[model samples]
Target: MINSHQALSDTVISNGYCVGCGACAVPEQSPFKILMDSYGQYRAHMDDSPVFGRTDSSYEELCPFSSSAPNEDDIAKQYYAETCEHHPQAGYYKGVYVGHVAEDEFRTRGSSGGMGTWVLHELLDKKRVDYVIHVRSETADKDLNNIPFKYQVSRTLDEVRLGGKSRYYPIELSQVLKTVRDQPGRYAVVGVPCFIKSVRLLQAQDPILAERIKYCVGLVCGHLKSAHYAESLAWQMGIPPSELEAIDFRIKDPSQPANRYSTYAKGPSGEKVVPTNNLFGADWGAGTFKYKACDFCDDVFAETADVVLGDAWLPEYVQDSDGTNVVITRNSDIQLLIENARNDGRLALDDLSIEKAVQSQDAGLRHRKISIGYRLHCEKEANAWVPTKRTKPSRTLNPRHEMKRQRLRTELRDLSHKSFLVAKKTGDLSVYTTAMTPVYNRYLIQKRSFLRRTYFLVKKTLKAMIGR
Candidate 1:
């Protein structure tokens, strides 16, 4: 016979089904709740705080980590169409990119352009929702990358501002579910694509969630990186992990150029200004540490979210670096609220087309189809079937196309070099320069000053004459 304690203790790396969403640790009031044990897996534990109770099971039912599930095909179809017509928030099916609004209340102060926090603030300040369930860091030392999370609501914008862009590491949904179970309040949630899907799945199983969850917001994600990335970044900045006090990923230094990403942190010695590109790539989608689970996600755009937000990546947007947010509204009320905010001059407005929006995240979108490969792999593993590689058709490769690719790479290499030389001349020994110093050291940094361009031009001339 299977022991009940054995089942409760099933949180493991391999055998356990923990998806690492932050649902379980949500309710600050739960008598018993979920926690990350020594093994890095979440298991339920007793928490008999008066705040924690067996209140409405709404968050529980909405939890994707819940054991019960509906038919996959049905769920997939609904998500693909993105219409829950029976719900109160109808008319949210996909269409031309909805109108855009940049709220002054949220713009400069938020993690990105501040839309994510703004939305949460609106829900709470306007009394649209009782609480906002979002991820916040539990660790003082962020170098470990594996910090626990807490799900709490910001009663005011100031409170929301306090938790801006922590992007706490190793957050899981099971924690949020436990929080909601114990804390009885209407809540809105913000998460990555998979986390949103899990919430939807939970709602299917639990009726209480259908009533409790007020809104869902999604962030654009290509992959989830490890703590080591942060540690490496700090180490590059000459601030070893041990000496660092606080780190802010998105540091806005208006004095600097727009594309130049600045990361700010405090250390035992003092404050440091480090460039962000070294910590994370400008194009995050292209890098490794793309989560393995993300490989199986088709909802890259957060098709299920009432509203989705991400960075607006485009040539025109290369400058104006306070960060412009790309937002998609699936809910009419939210859209109207934004419109009103814009009309009243409480926000800045920008009209963005869906085509352009998709282009910003092109690299990540390609992985949506690739997720099917992962799904198939999982099924094969479950069935103990051998996996076989399928032959892929080769496209006609023209040397001209290959040349274009090569030229782009060459240009990027040159640009990267230029950035380094600029940093060296400016005497800005930032994380951006240090982490990328090796590459620049090997190949000359692109000084972009008259000297480097002249050298390139001379090289091109020599190549042209040789061809003749």
Candidate 2:
């Protein structure tokens, strides 16, 4: 087996598989430190001091990208057993639904449906958990020195409400989790898929964490963005990186559809809100400021969490300006709470088919499940140490589609490092625009290719004929 530090450094850090979940640095007196790189992405860096002795294998074992950690399927099997229903793309779920919290104020403030925040709120109000570990804007005092947001331990309803919307900004768990380890409390934490998986792995090894962290609430992730994602959006609103103080990724516009939200940024001058579509590099598919590790992930539904929440992107609910959520509940108690809320008129929910759950994240599923295989194959060809994935590698892609996927994968891999580096050197966002415009254009071209269109048409026809 590779030594812990070498394994992590070579396979994950060097190859760009680290998601910066902070598991490695959360342990007591850990040697690794989590830092934001020039690209505005959270990355782990090892200290030069040898005081920690040989790297602990527990770090590798708990790392989401390490081969030593259990795959999503294995984790699901262990957690769900025979009671859960499974879908190839969505993993195990006890129930799937498209709904929204009935509370207008909460729904209006949430990223999509606000169910995630509500769940955390309920967990706290009911005294089920002593504190909630979630992401929130760093206090104004703290914002002067740090980024706008970070993971914090919230002990009251007001503090939890302050963290309502989704934060696409880069955040890691090390500092907050270190606090969790030292403090005494039952906690429910919300995170993206990889972060939740890392928590589970760490829980397996550390009994203290396992006891303190009671519930794992996961967000259905498309991918992660670098700090530049916010900077790019703010720049479009006439706020430069240095002057950007805060950014809200999802601001519900009364006139727009649920999918057409706005990004609001605060700077020294004032705050500006712009429709995401109006901003350059705002296309989620282009991977403008995406972390490279996201390309290697296959969990679109956060398979191992107690419950998963995401935007209801299906046509039926997409037009709802207030917002709607697509939810998958695996924990019986959480499911019952949802049912109780709906029954009491606090939540409006409709039973959703398992197929709909998969469809809600169809684009993400396609990228994570199918395109990932090809990406893996390419990594293998390059002799890279790819993280073990439940999705088997294959070159079985439509020729036109394969070309587009290959280009996107390569562009994204380079864009993460290059865009940030260029922006840092020039002290201008224009450098990023100039570098990414051409790449995004090519991606759009492939997306609209006649061959790609024909391939989809044929596939749809076959599926329809077979009644899929």
The candidate that achieves the highest lDDT relative to the unseen native structure: 2
Residue 390 deviation, candidate 2, in Å? Answer: 1.0
Question: What local lDDT does model 1 show for residue 247?
Answer: 61
Candidate 2 differs from the real structure by a C-alpha RMSD in angstroms, to one decimal, of: 2.8
> Can you tell me which runs of candidate 1 are displaced by over 4 Å?
1-19, 22-105, 137-150, 166-168, 253-259, 279-290, 370-468
lDDT of 2 by residue, 1-468 (tens): 656776677778888888888888877667789998888889999876776455476778888888877888888898887778888788899979898998746787788888989999998988889999998878823442235688999998888887788888899998888888889999999999999998999888889899999899999998998887888788779988888887878888889898899888888999888899999878787777888899899998999899999999999999989899999999887888889889999999899998987898887887888788888887897888888888777766655466565667578557746875787678877787787777777777877784577789899999999995
Please give the lDDT score at residue 148 for candidate 2: 64
Report the C-alpha lDDT of model 1 over 279-343, residue by residue, as the tens digit.
Answer: 53334433322333343444556666777777766666646667667777766666776667667
Indicate the TM-score of model 2.
Answer: 0.94
Q: Give Cα distance to truth, residue 389, candidate 1, Å.
A: 17
Report clash pairs, candidate 2.
Answer: none
